[model samples]
Target: MRDLQLYASEAQRYPPESVRNHMISNSIVPIARQFNEDMDALRGLLPTQTPCPLPARMAFVRNKKSLEGIIQRLDHRKIAATNIIARYNNGFHLLYLLANLSRLDGFRLHCNILSAADGIKALSVSQDALSQTLSRRHDALEAELQGQKAEVVEGLQYQGSKTSLALASLESRVHSQQQSLDELSSRMSSAVASPDVLGRMVRAELRQQLEPLLHRFADVSLLIDQIALGVSKKASEHSDFKTGGSGAIHGLSNPGSERRVIYTWVTTYRVRGSQDGYFRFRFVFMPRSWLCSTGISLVFSSGPDEFGHYSICPSILPIQIIPYSSPVWDIFERDDAFAVRQLVEHGKLGLRALTEFGQNLLRHAVHDNLPNICRYLLRDSGYGTLFLDDADMSMEIPWSLIADRSVEDDIESTREILQLLRAYSDSGDDSGNQSEWGWNNIFCSPCLSFEQKKSYGHLFLEFGATLRLFSWIRNDDMELNKSLLNFYLDTGGDPNQFAKTGIPPLLFALLLLSRGDIEPDISLVTILISAGADIYYIHDPDNDPDTARTTTDWAFALEVEDLWEAALEECGLDIASVYAESDRRLQDHRRLRGATRSGVDVESITEPGPSSELRRRAGQAGRRCEEGWIAE
Candidate 1:
């Protein structure tokens, strides 16, 4: 039973399915049962043999033949014993196989338990690391939320402060405006209380201010009227003197006795004809008053035997010579002549008027056959100084034409007529008190002192023709004057020659431009420039220092330079280049003049002098004349 218990314990150590059930059934189980049965039988037999002795059992196999039979039996018995032992060994081998299988199953179960334990330990470590990472993330999110909340709080505070400031400013402005409105209302109520008193006060103040001004204005007007009347009386006296009437007549009771009266015939040639057909002249003359209508008269004598005198008025001469509808007057009115024929025709009309008047006188002389009258008018009448009283008639007479027709037989009469006509035309009395003859007196008058004559002579020799041409320019004869200027320049007249007025021709032309009397003629300026007139030349300050003083007061140089630059541009010259070129040319010319005068005889040109200082002065005057210093 004990052995069976041990085997059952061993089998329980492993599951039944772990050990092979076939092995147990075929070998281990059967062997275990047979061994148990054999043990029981041996126990019964051993008790029976235990009563017998060991020598007595051996005596049964003693004799040889008997021994052989016995041996065979014994061999058979040995064979049987060996077979039992082999069967036991085979059963033991089955037990050993089942034990090994049980052990293998136990080892596999232990390995599986170790693997499950390792897996559980790794899962716990991973869980610990994940929890730490989640804790760190939670802390970071809390910090970020705190920062955002603080920034929101700061923004709200800033917005609240700005709103407070804006509201305060608006409230203050509203208060100021309300105060202004209240003050304006109070002032308006006060103004509305006394409207009539305010109006009267305003009106009284205005009248009080204006009364003295009105009285002063009336007094000034009365004074001005009295002054105007006196000025008119003086102006009339001056006009009488200018027009060759006797202003001394106002101081004289018998004004007609002061007049110097004479009579002459218009022609001296006698013709074979009847008694009296001649023009008689009468003259009562003042200085330069021969052409005055109040000082002269004309009469026609036409009768066979009786001397009948008919008066002719001098004022009716121009009306008869040029009727209102005449084309000659039209030429004067239009003031523009396109062709030479037009000018010639106009001049012919003037000549025709003088010629016809002379012819009429000649006819009356021939018809009267007045030999005694011709002699009395030419030699005995003493009327040679008398002139025609009409100024317009004298101007239109063409005195040169009349001189050309003078006869040797009537030479004295022709000379007397020409002298009177020239004196009448050239004197200032013909135009007005103001002389229209510019710079002519400097050359024509012979009564000047020697020094004055010398100074004027130089100017006249240098610029006489040009000055006369300028006179034509004043008469609206620009084309003729331009031609005359060109001719004078062609004949070696210096365009830069200064007049006695101490003004250059170009400066005079510029003065005319300033006066708006002439258009800016580029051609005329170019001609002057080409004839050696300096574009950049300024008048010497020593000659006319007043010009500089006036320029400073008026700032005239800027205006002059602007006009000059504009004129140069109109003439198609670049102003800067022209100015530079002109300065260069002037320098060259000055150098040339200085070099040429180095060996000149200074003493030969000066007057005979008593002292060194006078000689020096005369030398300086000669040099100044050579340098063209015209005296004003």
Candidate 2:
């Protein structure tokens, strides 16, 4: 009704006398009807005496008259929710009633109060209450309470029997097992620890434990003769073999063996504070023909000494030896073999381009760290061709690239590959998106320039990118959101984007959410989360009185609180629910980052796989980047 009045006012149109009279009638009559309907609904739900009090009665008369005047005047100012609420002393009651009705009807009433006077705020709720609700995390508390109840009940039931027997048995069994477990644990620990008394103790125990089996074996020469006989018997099983073909010996059949000889050479490098960190070489199995055609498998380690190097250990076969440096020569010896003939028949060009790019940046020219680069690249090169931007300062081979091993260790190359495919590559075709903006267009590249020639410095550019990302996400610009998300993960996009901008992604996300513009995207949220963006907890430090050193600032926290409450009021969502979700995400990411920093195993880090939806958005962004325009 207030919206109607506002529209009338904005349109500069007042209803005719007949229309005004009708509106006046409806305004006065509708409230009374609403009051009666509400009272009827709550009669059974609340105390019977909770009707309009004396003060409320007087205010209700004023409210009644104001509604009538609003229709007669056809003025927007007189018909907003606030004036009506103020006119009626029971404004909160009216609001509460309307809120209940709206919820029951499954409709949203963005107006502050369903009144016929005074401008209605889009949302309502005292700021403090909102903050408490967002911060309290009520759901977690409820779950905790429920868990406690279950645990307490279990404890009571198990106290006398389960608890007692478990305790009694634990100590008894622990005493027996402790000696062996502790010794074994220590002995195993010694292998990774120091090599002295403890190490010798472990080695002696392991070797002595296995040596007795060797003594039970038959005489060496007699056993060899028997093994040879077994090898010949096994070779004779092949239909192609003659009755005595097992004795051909050129193929070197051993005692009960069907073994093929393989030899590989591996090399390793050193790591800081560690003995092993090296690259390795392996001879992967290929057909004999492939071996002659240079179809050899070549594997190299990206880092230092890795696990599982080549070794020759014959169990029950006669082995042939070739020159260690020339494993290829050994394959050439089988040129006349059937496997070699098959390779010549099929693929003359046996091996695909085989170059161990290794730590060489040139060979691995794809700088997966540049989503902005792809954006920039698409500007010049067709979207079908994602060009690598040399201008990206971060991509330039840094002195620290080789010098900073610690930083390098933290980088996951596979993640980069995944991010690149996610951000730049089009799913439908192998080609990238087409170019729309120019090669040097600033806006085309989503990333801030690290080069000094750009208007904003590197840090500010990063900061702006963060803001744009938040804005896009908030607007539910899925394409932009996806690209920004990819940018964040792939480029390690600016964590401190808000550092200079004075506005973080969390706050923006909350603000947009409050405005009822968009819902949250957890993927983008996850990226910000990993980068230390938290809505609930702000890193505010206090200033020292003596030194005047500022420890932290809680301004962000206050802003978040204000925005959160406003959002709750706007969205009509449970304030506690939103807050709990925020805290859970924030705390989880903080813990995740902490774990990574504390040297937790790489395997432990949960990999967020490619979101198919995200890929779709990226594909769209790629197309959008090709067709440049203002993002609505």
Per-residue lDDT tens digits for candidate 2, residues 107-163, read 211121232122112112334566778678787798899999999998898787887
Task: Give the Å shift of residue 233 in candidate 1.
Answer: 22
What CA RMSD would you report for each candidate?
A: 48.9, 43.6
lDDT, each prediction: 0.38, 0.34
TM-scores, all candidates, are 0.24, 0.16
Model 1 clashing-pair count? 0
Off by over 4 Å in 1: 1-481, 487-494, 497-500, 515-519, 540-563, 566-632
Model 1: per-residue lDDT, tens digit, 1-632? 34553664566577766655422333344444443454343233221332234342333223224434433443443344334434554446544544454355336434533443444455456667878999999999999999999999999999999998987876565444433432111112122344445445534543333333334235423333433343333332323211111122212222233443343434321224745344334222221122222222343323121233334444222212333344544443332223213444555532213111223221222222333332333234343122222222222222223322212223334334434334434322222212223233332233443344234334333322222323322423355445545644544445656654555566655554454455544455545544545454535446332332221112144245556656556544566565554444334335444221235544321121122111111233334434644222
lDDT of 1 at 186: 10
